[model samples]
Target chain A: MAETTDLDVAYVARLARLQVSDDERRTFQAQLGDVLRYAAKLAEVNVQDVEAAAHAVPMFNVFREDRPRDWFTADEALQNAPRSANDLFIVTKVVE
Target chain B: MTAAELPALTISELQPLLRGGAVSPGEVVDALQSRISEIEPQIDAYIALDFEAAKHEANAADLSLPLGGIPIAVKDIISVAGQRCTCASRSLSNYIAPYDATLIRKLKAAGAIPLGRTNMDEFAMGSSTENSSVKITLNPWDKSRVPGGSSGGSAAAVAAGAAFGALGTDTGGSIRQPAAFCGIVGLKPSYGRVSRFGVVAFASSLDQAGPLTKTTRDAALLMNAIAGVDPQDSTSLPEPVPDYTQLLGREIRGIRIGLPKEYTTDGIDPQVKAAVDAAVTQLQALGAEISELSLPHTEYAVAVYYVLATAEASANLARFDGVRYGHRTEGVANLVEHYERTRAEGFGAEVKRRIILGTYVLSSGYYDAFYLRAQKVRELIRRDFVEAFKKVDLLISPTSPVPAFKIGERTADPLQMYLADIFTIAANLAGICAISLPCGFATSESGTQLPVGLQLLASSLDEARLLQVAHAFEQSTDWHQRRPPL
Candidate 1:
């Protein structure tokens, strides 16, 4: 039996802070299940004792000199937002 | 300025006219705007085209840049300084970028006007632009069908005569597939060939920035402008960027071109097969040697790509919390709900599905069975290309199995959608260089007329050689000259 449920989809969306419509929730539930159906093929291989490979271009723990650099200013950062309050993105206190 | 007559003059041809004072950049920009207005109702190529701003840029650019004033389109996922970088997601719909992407800076430095951000699959997650949260981008070749995506908007923009060239990102064939579907040239350079500093990440591991143009030489020219290391992205290669255009006229006299047997196996389109074979023959005529090569792990490409891409998407998307520039839900009293509601509302079905699958695969219990094993398979797939590269200078294959399908054709089936990218995804996974150029025509199941693409791939840092092959074949064919009936 598949280990997925409508609640799992709803829960995941909730965790992501997205408000999905009922139609969207149903669409995602089925689509996500089908996507997982193909993704389950990874379970067939034996990966014990194998090291992990992350980035396609191989790099390991890329380090910088730790010198402080002045990144974009707060005013510049918020320049493109539709709304901002006190140098921060303005959003409704969205919690249930 | 109908689409029929537009394909004859490449960006290189048009730029010179603008530069030599034979034509004003404003005239060219106006011609494109007029054509876009005429056909965009049916094709739906652009999410936003800043025609007024572009005209201003073109006027200013004529006096400053080398190309008098060539207009360029940017994939929606990338930032253009102060413009909106939506990635076709509602989450960032209200967000505008604070700075330009490295390539956008480079394009502007070269005097290209950014018309506006083109539409894309939401978060650059799907093969078809149908996954876009904003709006769907249709193929310019046949308005009813899909332009290969997440760069679908870029492809459609160029295909429909909205612009001469455009920039696109490729994680899993986003650039090449759409270019193929739209009958243009798309190049995905070596992983570090272009910096990803301000381009929104979908799958950082395999994601790259490259060009979509009307010809391979234009791709090369754009590559020359865009390719290089940047201080912003540390993984960017520090090597000197080579001159790609100079290599076009040179003969590939003794270069070895390899045809991968796995690519030509069952389920291959007969027309695509014939077209690629003819391209191979043309390469031979151009004094290049051809050989049959085998990549045994070809079947594992899709499996490897999905696992790795999703795992990265899961991590990269975590930054879109309510605290940032993107959308945040209101009326939720708590912080946790803030994150949940914002994402649930912002992300599309495909993105939500992938995030869940990605999270599930990387979760504790399934880590060993899924993520670790998939990494090992990735190593094996990369090795297959490395071994094949030792035998041949370049690999040839059909870019997509069939031509473009209708808008709703494969939307219902998830895996079937993924199958379209089977051939083009391998190069991204392997971190190699690949180019897709127009090959010939493909008749769809419904008797629709579409164009097929032939992909030329090479090992890492071999873009010069790949472009040489593409440019050589393009010299022999008139397929690149064909455009939409509009």
Candidate 2:
């Protein structure tokens, strides 16, 4: 096993837009440390000239002709919003 | 038809009966309702059921169409218009799908009825269905044990005869492992074979929606209706679709199978190895040549899978901000606080763990060491399969290291739970097709006999050959014919 360093749980959580409690921060830090340690095994492989595969199949520039088609109506798009007013999503005031 | 006969009928068996007017769709639905009412309470396989709606659809169904009137369970992760597609999470518990998924539209066009929404791991993250916030789904074979997951509900429902067949999305063995645990047939089609248009994203690169059925032929039957390209999904393949059921009962005289050496690594239970070995012998007897092969990078599959899957999941799941359709936190001071609180409160522990792990790997200074390295390793894993296929047409292994464990056995250790998916995850990572079906049984320490699965894998876009050989093996054995005592 590799000597894995502890991850900054609070910092990562902030980037992920998740508010972590103190206890959760401790738990995640230890757990993430263990997983990263296991994941360090990837470094043992010689990937000298191997290309990183982002997609399973080789796909490039998959585009269809730019044509307008029927899409979800505004009512359908906003159907699931928890709070909506006047056909717009209601959210906390920005630009204070 | 007698009530006992209804649950045992496969899709092929019911096709003629419905077409010839020997049985009405209403009768089929009634029989299924009786079976569900009896077994559903004990198994907890369904998150939601629309029996009245299904009956209405059944009554109006055109009996002339393929798959006409067959009731199929839809995993909650897939969209069913006007239905609650919760993905077994509290985050979207109240959200209803605005429109049908591409697969759903196809199934409806083929005259199949959407039976109900099935439970799954929250965000399809965990191996066991215990991660579901809705309820723990029990194995119909033994209520004390789990039906393997994250497709546990669909597998359990099929095993319990609650639905004729079901659909499940496989990412890291979510479908196959559960199907194995429940002693049913499950297929994870090649990544692009099935559209992911409205299937809730877990690990986008790994997820493919496939069928879970009582038999291999039934899996082929469902695949015929649901497998195709969709304009809505850019990742969908433009490959020509074939009638998967057309070649059922085909001969497999010259098929070559490879048994990888790495799958026999530590932690494989003796009973599971014995069952899969016996299955290989049985296939050999049916005239398919078998050989030993090696995939040296197999040991690193689990490690590489976690890095890439979590990274994709973290990005995909970021859409669930409180301002949108999912659960939202109240009394937040600002937009940032609202986003933070909503995510913290909405997601479960396992989901949050992956999110943080993903966020960390994709973070600055760690991207090269973690994410990029894992992707390169992933390429090697795919290359291993590509090379192995040169020697043999397909590979065989144990779907899981062991049968279903006690419900709460591995919940305390996420690593232990992740290991349950070891054998099935590689196929997904390679974007290849694979299937799991009953091979034999494993007796537990308590004398409970649980089902074991034998997995078969083929190279990408070789589903036709894969199904042909699987159907041949299935027809020769009685394993798929057995049902749970439930």
The residue-by-residue lDDT of candidate 2 on B183-218, one tens digit each, is 999999999999999999999999999999999988
Candidate 2's C-alpha runs over 4 A off are A1-3
Error of 1 at B24 (Å): 2.3
Q: What is the C-alpha lDDT of each candidate?
A: 0.81, 0.91
Clashing pairs in 2: none
TM-score of each: 0.92, 0.98
Clash totals, every prediction: 19, 0
Query: What is each candidate's DockQ, to 2 decimals?
Result: 0.43, 0.72
Candidate 1 lDDT, B379-438, residue by residue in tens: 777878989989889998999987787888888877788878899988987899999999
